[model samples]
Target chain A: MQDDAKLIEFIKTDLARGKVTGKLGANDDLIETEILDSLGIMKLILFLENNYAVKISDEDLTLENFTSIMSINSLIQRKRAAQGA
Target chain B: MDFSFTDTQVLQRESIVEFARRELNDKVRENDQAGGFPLENWRKCADMGLLSLLTPEIYGGLGEDLVTTANSLEALSYGCEDSGLVHAIVTQLCCIVLINLYGSPAQKERYLPELSSGGMIAAQSITEPDAGSDVLSMRTRIEGDGAGWLLSGGKVFISNGPLADIIIVFARCGAGKSAFGEISCFLVEKTAAGYSMGKPLQKMGLRTLQNCEMFFDSVGVGEEMLLGKNGHGMFIFNEGIEWERALMTAAHLGTLERVLGKSISYVKTRKQFGKEIGKNQSLSNKIGTMKLNLELGKLILYKMAWLKDQGKRATLEASLGKLFVSESLKSACLDAIQIHGGYGYMQECDLERDLRDSVAATIYSGTSEMQRNIIARMLGI
Candidate 1:
């Protein structure tokens, strides 16, 4: 139920599916590979906010932060740290 | 689960229908023939707070929720014969919706009042000569210069482009890790240096609404004008397009009702073989299909509206609704023209004009093909 595990599970199950024809690694690019498109990006953002109780503001909406499972975990960690939780 | 409109919503819809019927129909044919923008009707809608349906109350808006706003737009499109004017209103409202969604406090304070009051018209500049549906492929570049930003690009087929007081320009600001992530939106004033608009582009339909080509030749804008963040333009566009696909075309539901009404009236009264056309199984079957399409379209749109009102992500719902309603509208118009036969082909009957306007429904706000692609992608195809 940790944030990182939850994110990976949701991304692989909900967004990736058969759209990602090739293997997806932890640091593989979701956007460049077209595994996660604009709508997928949105769904991921919504999922992160809803499940993790974090607000991904406009500034946080970036490829560097959302292009991979690793990057997404980094963003969540940074946000949680800022909240001093 | 509740399908009935509240008393207040019913009153609002009735008043809007009455106002549009009384004030928005004058010179519509002439305007269409000349391809003129209905500034008078635009101002009338502003005065009636139609322009402010989605804005916050602090910014002089009626602040209607998505469902109510969709209902009001449906009533307006039903009463108003000029589809172009309705098109223009929705385009302006789309710009307003983006501003409200992404604009900073100061930006909202600066623009929302004027936008809500109709003192300033707005356009969204995204499509380019090469980029129609592939928005991220746009070559419009935005580079930073420490103090401000430089924007240089040309946008084509921009609704409200010719007369807009301000425009939301989407441009590429960074290479990022992906092509889709580097785009950023800037609020550019029409009067800004090196900003110019081409002559209003004449079109096959929706002529009463102006579409134009715009150029931003290294136009400089302050940091204050950077909507959302520097590299969040794609997100802004995605959000805006989702709204447009869902709510902007809500009027088409009303257009379906209008088309069905006209068809029904024609079939009921226009006699052939000494009997009403509605009496024929073949002709009546077409009318039945139109009715079915209208009912289904309204249900989809209303459900989309309700979902939006509940603050849900509706990418799938929006694309489905847009595809269904737009394709259905085109078919209904064709059926209407067929029902009216020779009279429908004539300008006097106005069904031909309606048909022309309906064609653009599928083309704009993402084409039916694009909708299909979005849906297929969501399905993991």
Candidate 2:
């Protein structure tokens, strides 16, 4: 499975789960746009934790960390590589 | 924004509902009739750490955030029959959350453990016979006596008044001060001298939790009892109220769902005009409206909770949630009563109790009118 494809799918599913609609863009404000409010982030964190097998510490959970599909995918790759995955 | 709870949240919700069902329900009618507080149920809830839903574990609380707390309360309301019992729990939780957020370390050390462990029942006393919704109009005052503060005032419509060991009292200080900025909240213990309760009020609903009046005449407390800054207590009060208004009726969303399901079953099974009442367009439409309200109410409240969990100031969202759910539940309860017909009018089978409980919702924690004011103000209307 391509990581980018899967990440896009995850984001789409999350968007649907929240019943929020908009054109996917790299710069959408997740919270300001009402896309991924508090619970959505928690759910996303849980999803990433399970699927990526990456332990996301409290400090790492930030808007900076998950603002875009590229950001999340890059962070996942970095973490997985650091873990020698 | 997401209506579905996460795994832990779902479990928390289930556990609270189970705890309420196992510990409460059967005794609700008797307690409601007698206007008595549910001491044993209070203990049971505390043992389950139900009271600490909002408090952090650092202060001997569960330390969960707003979403988990909302889920727990929703389940508790769903499984529990006595709105009075649930109201008392909500009142205590509201007060304790403020204590955890703003109280001194000594205050937390003393009260959080006691409250979370069910060592004592708690109350939030701010409504006075005169104060009502215009909080600044409070006649209660805390005089800065040479040896601690002397409290002289009375509060009415206080939930859990008869049972609280420590009641959080909001008072207006500096009589000439600005209307919105000079309020203070104090943690007054029930055992304090000159602190007494009047006969519990016969409430329109939620009677099992012991709604009543309390008088604080020369009630004294040390400097340490002040929660937050003296003049900034309105901040703490409003914070508690925001959380209360947002999450308190969450369980009622589930209650709405339950009532809708009940109504559907009634209309489906019971023969009316030689057919199921649900087959009639009017009855189905009523249930449909109820279902719509229930789903939308849940979405709004959960969104508010999500906002809180993200460190966002969700004042507007919370007000919106409160407005929608409180008004929506009114619709649900009225429909439930209609579906049950004469049986709903009777004192049997919890529809009456549910109706009574819903009546109190539009009034407490900021009335529906007040909620609209907040929402409109937020909208700059």
Candidate 3:
């Protein structure tokens, strides 16, 4: 839940650039809504890697993994779990 | 954290510099003036094993790391007066690196040996008339035929387009407003039916490097020619650009060093008002800034190279480095010309040529404006 809020905030502030003034729901499609383009996705990955202390491989860069805040947070959680294991 | 080159790297740089000085500079001015591609020099570079610097040993390449590759390119740029030749070599190197990174075992076995050995030249065609920086907006379309894919589109401003026997062409393979899961890359041979190249387009600078327009009228490519997975072209293209931005600007380091050395020599020897011109504060300041920019550029570039060597994605660093190094090279070239005064303006002096060549540095790979946009986006601006 905390990761969800942080990811949503990042998308609103950094990726969406204030265009997303209203509440960004966890399930809202970042890609379909055009909030995150290709470059934005890369920047978001860097943020996730640095903030969460996890590495995102090229194979992990998929539309499914980055379509929404929930998806991104889930990806972060998965990477963290993998690291811990 | 260590910035110093290894002993082997140092020797490699020296040997490449020596080879470039000995063989690459001949008829450079004439070739640039004629807007001709120096095929002889290309063959010489291949023979010198420069073409194989980034490929794996199994594919006939030296498999040098990114830092060592950057060092060799820098040395080549420093020693060779022909910026066009250097640019062409870097283009080829980037293509080779891209294929090696993403090519399948079959793809690698088929293309890497010939490309690394300089038996065949390759071009990466992505830019279109409407889509230079906005690559996703490209109109190139690829449809899956019963047997293979049919590529139909045109690419402009393609380096080595005329000379490349194999071209990596990007086309939209899926329906999407976004580049994700839409773009795909194809390795189209020059012999492919309906594939044609226009005559080389004359350019303002880097004239020795050939630039041409490529047209495909339903060119057939086998399924085997697809690079990476379908819909992975955007990722592959971005990765290739990252590498290109980081490593291609290395040649500018050599050019900057050469321009700085020549400017300093001229200012110290040339007399004005009964004294050496370099003694003046204005002249000295300009040279000092050139030195400063050179050092700063080196720091940004070498750090980017080091980051890539550490297996880290350096998209941000690559943009920052490309922005700084390219703009600095342009400024240094202008300062070199100003320091040389009239002699610099003359074609015989070659400072003007460097200035002309420097303009394209800010435009190619990605423009200065594009680099700033990427940096700003990374900063969340």
Candidate 4:
């Protein structure tokens, strides 16, 4: 969970820098509201895949796992936990 | 605040830069001189994911987002020497993104995988001699046939026309209706009996891109060929135009930055009147303006990307961005050329190429005039 928080911070860091948003005010559905496009989503995927020790196949990047901040946070958490990170 | 790349996006840009510098920088001049497409490097681009960034993964595409694709194109543009190849990639992506977003599943199953992998190149045919900026004014039409529709029309100035594996075409589906409501786009294979491509046409810029005239004489297409709906071609095409016009010139923005960087390096080193040209205010302002355009253009593109991601309509924003960047690039290229002095005018330095290439930014993806028209209408003109 701490790792997930870190990932969220990292993403928020990107958002802040990109001037996308200040802090991702809501925890859920940030992605679906057009806060991030597929490119931003892919960038998030690469970060998670490398840093959080998750294997993000093409299927995992869909709306199901990535539609919201909460879902993305959960996905990061689950993947890290599974990887024993 | 922090509108730049994450570490991965940075690496993506770097990798493409390396590939382009290693493969494209030197060959661009030769290919342009020869008036030939660089077939070898094109496939290399496909292998590297330039072609399939948007097709959904189920169909074997990397299915990258608009942001990733935009960044990648910019990086590639900065490193590579060929604007024509970049334009060709744009044409392919434009057509393919439309198909993936709106084409039927069967269409997806049949085409996306090959397109992503570069086994097929697609062309979009919408412009006509009489219908340049006004897209719906074209006279092409599709009437009902036995099990499919027989399309008959011609599209001119089609990018990637001579080399396309599948051509996405728009034709009128009903008479005496709003052109917007009467036209539909379709997917037709190169091998389709009645679909024929003309010889590649000479272009003032984008010379290596295979822009050509195309003919569709009773080209028969199945019911599955209908993209989106019978009359939704306009909708699907409009959906991506903002990004296409506004942000797709990301590479051009990058080119301005690259040119500015080159000028900075040269001015500091090259002695002019027995002193570095960096000592001049005029030269410094030239680079400053280039830098200004780069940063401003990026912000505009970033806003469009953000807006599109948010499910917001960005037509007005897009037109403004397109208008600003397209005109800025032409001006930047001219300024860059001026800074290079005699060398810039000569073919030896890359500045002349930049100047020639920047000429088309106002023409393609809808002319700058058209963008103004769109913007004016949005402003209630």
Error of 1 at A67 (Å): 3.2
i-RMS for every candidate (Å) is: 3.4, 14.7, 1.4, 14.7
- Residue-wise lDDT of candidate 1 within A1-85, one digit each (tens)? 3766777767777787765555557798887767676567777777877787787777787667877888888899899899886
- Provide the TM-score of the second chain in candidate 4: 0.96
Q: After superposition, how far is residue B262 of candidate 4 from its true place, in Å?
A: 1.7
Top candidate (DockQ): 3
lDDT of 2 by residue, A1-85 (tens): 3876666666666543444465565555455554454234544565677788886653465456676776788788888998999
| Cα displacement (Å) at residue A23, model 3 | 1.0
Q: Interface Cα RMSD for candidate 4?
A: 14.7
**Which residue pairs clash in candidate 4?**
A17-B2, A17-B3, A18-B2, A18-B3, A34-B309, A34-B310, A38-B65, A39-B65, B53-B64
- Residue by residue across B174-219, what tens digits does model 4's lDDT show? 6532322466778888898898878899877778888899998898
Docking quality (DockQ) of candidate 1: 0.35
Candidate 2 TM-score, C-alpha based: 0.78
The TM-score of chain B in candidate 3 is 0.98
Q: What are the Cα lDDT values of the candidates?
A: 0.85, 0.76, 0.88, 0.75
How does the DockQ of candidate 2 come out? 0.02
lDDT of 1 by residue, B92-202 (tens): 888888999999999999999899889999999999999887766788999875589889989999999998998999998875445455788999998899999999998
- Span of 10 residues, lowest total lDDT, candidate 3 chain B: B173-182
For A1-85, candidate 4 gives per-residue lDDT tens digits of: 5765666676666533454454554365654354453224434554666576677643353455665567787787777787787
Specify the highest-TM-score model's number: 3
Lowest lDDT block of 10, candidate 1 chain B: B173-182
DockQ of each: 0.35, 0.02, 0.62, 0.02
Regions of candidate 2 where Cα sits further than 4 Å from its true position: A1-85, B1-3, B145-147, B177-181
